[model samples]
Target: MSFVDRLRELRLDAGVFRRATDRGANESAPSAFIRPRPIESRSSKEQSVGRRQSSNEFSGRRFFSSAAGSPVSRPAVSSPKKVYPTANNSSWTTEAKEPAGERQVIKVGTGVRPDDPPSSLCPKPRSPKLKVGITLMTRKPHRFDWWLRYHRNLGICHVFVHVEDTPELLPLLDSDEFAGFVTVTTGDDNSLDTHNPNSPDNYYTLMQRQEEQVRRSVVSARRMGIQWLFHIDDDELLHLTEPFSRLVRELGSDVTCITFVNIEATPKSLNAECVFEEIDTFSQHLMLAYRNGKSAGRVSVADWHGPHRFTGRYCVVPVERACILHFESCTYEQWRNKFIKHKEMGEAKKNDIPFPFYRDSVTLFQEDPSGGKNEQRWKAFYQERKIEHFEQLHEDEKIRIRLTSCPKQMIDGASGSFCKWRNA
Candidate 1:
């Protein structure tokens, strides 16, 4: 039996997978969970046309709310790790906290360049021009154009965009600013499900689609002669300071991947129409802002921090620099429209999954044959046990923006965000 099948059996054995009406039938039924939307592949030529069409496809918008509430609202937990000794009543031991100063030299390039960058003091040699690949998964044109400009201004030699097959994006794809600097990749909307794994409706096919997307996107960057592959979803944007070129020169060999600041923004009830504003800056970018509080223009989050397994929203292998911005949340209308589009896609495709996955406290996976009842029960139990904690999180919930100059000091093997750390 497949792992999923075994898992289903376990859920039943554990008394969590079935509804009270269910009798653990011998014959399985068609999965009620909708399949996830397919990821856009850079290899697809259709993406080059940048055509927006009306069909049953997922909308990249409105998956989450301004409150960021949704069944998908599971707070990404930190990766597992070894606990370091604490200072309480323990003998003080020491370990090197800072990265070792020495770097291993690595020569980059297929052939020697006429004007190659100088050999680094590190053992490795620098590549010709730093190649960067950028991914944006959105149907909207406004945010797409912004990212294009950022990469071009950053002197990045190449750019790749992943957007749904939509006509609204054609003009921008055809724009002079994007000329020669951009390549559009086609994405299928059918592979965008956000169902919980516990749901019997959750199909292995949906999970595979997501994995394929990550694999294909990374492979495309490798094919493009890009040493660094950066990721930014539709709503997210990256911010950076030093030209990536300078960063390549400085951290050439030691750096492999980079983590960037995640700046969470939301439409706030300002003086007039809802205006998008940053509420929190991840620690990395927080240092970049004027202590006096000035808005540093939007930047790609991939530029600074490396990818955390939990917050894969933005991250990349080392290209030339080490900083970027992430604008994951935007205005409410745009957000709502996104969910509406996804719902339409679901209905047309016959997936029939509810729009937004979570509505009026109902999760998209609630109908899945697996643990649908238990999942609901778990949520209710969580609310009951941690009512105060959940309320505090909701009440204090505000936009978060972070900026970090050095990521190595802030991240551990588990990839937890440590605002401060000392060797012990």
Candidate 2:
């Protein structure tokens, strides 16, 4: 028999028709009393055929049961979908029925992720300003206050001082005038023994100590974020014709050094008590031995041969406007003592042909160790030389004259026009 005929026969035998007929005739029939129709038994071949047909009709379809007690089918999704958390603390996902070719970008959140690129929309941080500092190696504490005041007036922001004699000079560092700006340090305890012939410090040992002190100051300046560093002595005063900061900013990156020629200032009389006060007059002749202008940046102190030049590998830029005013011949007592010290340190042995100034000073000291008659002779010699009045000249004229008066040896291939003044 056919599958449908068999199903009919099985329902009739189970009395399903009687129950359905009774429910239709009585409108008041309870739902609980009305029984469901029993499924009819079928052969394995017939069951397999029915399952195959059902699967075919329901392929790519989903079913939903309605309130009217009927099953409805809708098209099913084909692609997988993902949900992501958004900025408003809510979850969202792409439409399952969206076309495969099109993609919508979802801003995940306002917060940054580990793999996200840095945001260019935000403002960048500002950089710090560059600073400059000066280093001084001073043996005389009495002149410290004066030196500090002079440079501070020239817009010097920071200072590093290495006092040669700390015990006598340490009290000066505590002054209120130098509270925030100045740093005081002591000389090295392991300084060279002047008496030992085999020691490295014996030969130019004083210069060696000065170099070591300067080196330490340079390192300290660098650590403190000082972009430019200048080294000067206690007796030397640097006069900047222009603003020091402007000069530093104008220097090229490749130019690491700046040299200034020295102009020796002599007193009218060797009997003058204070040379600093008598600095109104300066010598017309340029002292080739003392070129001691301050250096640029952090150069090695050992590289500095004298106050005038740096021997290291650097591009040296000479400042025509700025010059170091040296009070090398201040007083009779100071000069005599300085000469004696140099003589004891074997200065005469080192120089085969010493400068006339040194030779004369040593001769006079030898002839009159008391410095009474020698002072008068040196005073007469200085007075005979015509000295230029610094205050009377114009700023440009002073720079021009000094530059013109510089010795050729101090500057490479430099031809000064004031040749007549050298002999005068």
Candidate 3:
């Protein structure tokens, strides 16, 4: 507490400070505690370095140059950025398919992308010059537009339509919608009796009418340079494992006629709706329909003799992969409406040579023209067509094929033809 004692303590403190100042910031110390720094002339003083190694040396490793003692920064090596590929991305999908908009490229640190699957999986469409046409005689068809669009998507360049009685379809087929695609004919050609096309006496039956239409259509097909002409009813569709063009191109040059086995459709109910969408499960063997199958003859050399038979320099080849999707009595309304209209084909008179379905249907129409009294019998016919169970498939209904898509789907859209559920 005395003034003399305080003065002695102050002098001792001043001496300790002077000794620490002598060492200065330039001195290397074990502890990172505060040190004294002195101002110097600009000539000798390192501008940034000043008289210190680093003001905050503890933040990181501070390496200083031997000459000027300035700090040098050598950043730590960084690991690569993690790239977790998302589902449904270019990580694994077709190269032909790109993102909706302009694509972006992100080059990761020294990372390499693996080669993708070849584009050959989605082959390009065939040349349109190699034309294939369909010769059909449809009368008031259900989903006739769908049939046209389906075959068009299947690479049928042209369609020769014989309007048995559907005059409305004539203009519709000749419209811009089907201008160059369809060749329409009404009344009768020079090939048949023009006077009485509807008469029971002349080409009135289903077989005769169909053959006559096909025969005349073949000449048109040949003249128009249509290589192959197929005769398929509006009730039936051409089903293929691959593209039809590919199959036709694969056929031997010498082969004139191509026959495909028929797969009959088994309706689930009398509720007639969209046939292709509603009907997915088809029976390999024909139960209530013909099993002989349908044929497509090359128009250049072959003549359309019958529905299935072709004449002139014939070399027939069977492709097991393709078949006809026959919607024979697919629905109650379809069955009733189709056959009921052609009562003449039934008991009204001999349809000349009606198919088994027509024969059976027209017989009912013949028995009961109105189908009023035989309603239960008609119901029985529809019920019999239903497949009760896969466990107990009939001998004719052995192999059951569940199509991946609807039979009336584009080749590219088959995988995405879950339209039933989407529309629902």
Tell how far residue 108 is off in model 2, in angstroms: 70
After TM-score superposition, what is the CA distance of residue 103 in candidate 3 from its true location, in Å?
Answer: 54
TM-score quality measure for candidate 1: 0.39
Report the lDDT tens digits of candidate 2 across residue range 23-107.
Answer: 4643332111012122222222233221111101112321212232212333345652322222222333333333323221211
Question: TM-score for every candidate vs. truth?
Answer: 0.39, 0.51, 0.57
Per-residue lDDT of 104 in model 1: 15
Question: Could you tell me how far off, in angstroms, the CA of residue 364 lies in candidate 3 after the best superposition?
Answer: 2.2
Query: In lDDT terms, how accurate is model 1?
Result: 0.34
- Candidate maximizing TM-score: 3
What's the lDDT of the predicted structure labeled candidate 3? 0.54
Name every residue pair that clashes in candidate 2.
291-307, 291-308, 292-307, 292-308
Query: Which candidate do you rate higher for TM-score, 1 or 2?
Result: 2
CA shift of 417, model 3, Å: 13
Q: Write model 1 residue lDDT over 223-302, tens digit each, in one string.
A: 66666655555544444323344333322233344444332232232121212123232221112111111011012222
Question: lDDT of all predictions, in order shown?
Answer: 0.34, 0.44, 0.54
Point out where model 3 deviates above 4 Å: 1-129, 188-197, 200-204, 245-250, 313-320, 341-358, 373-377, 385-424
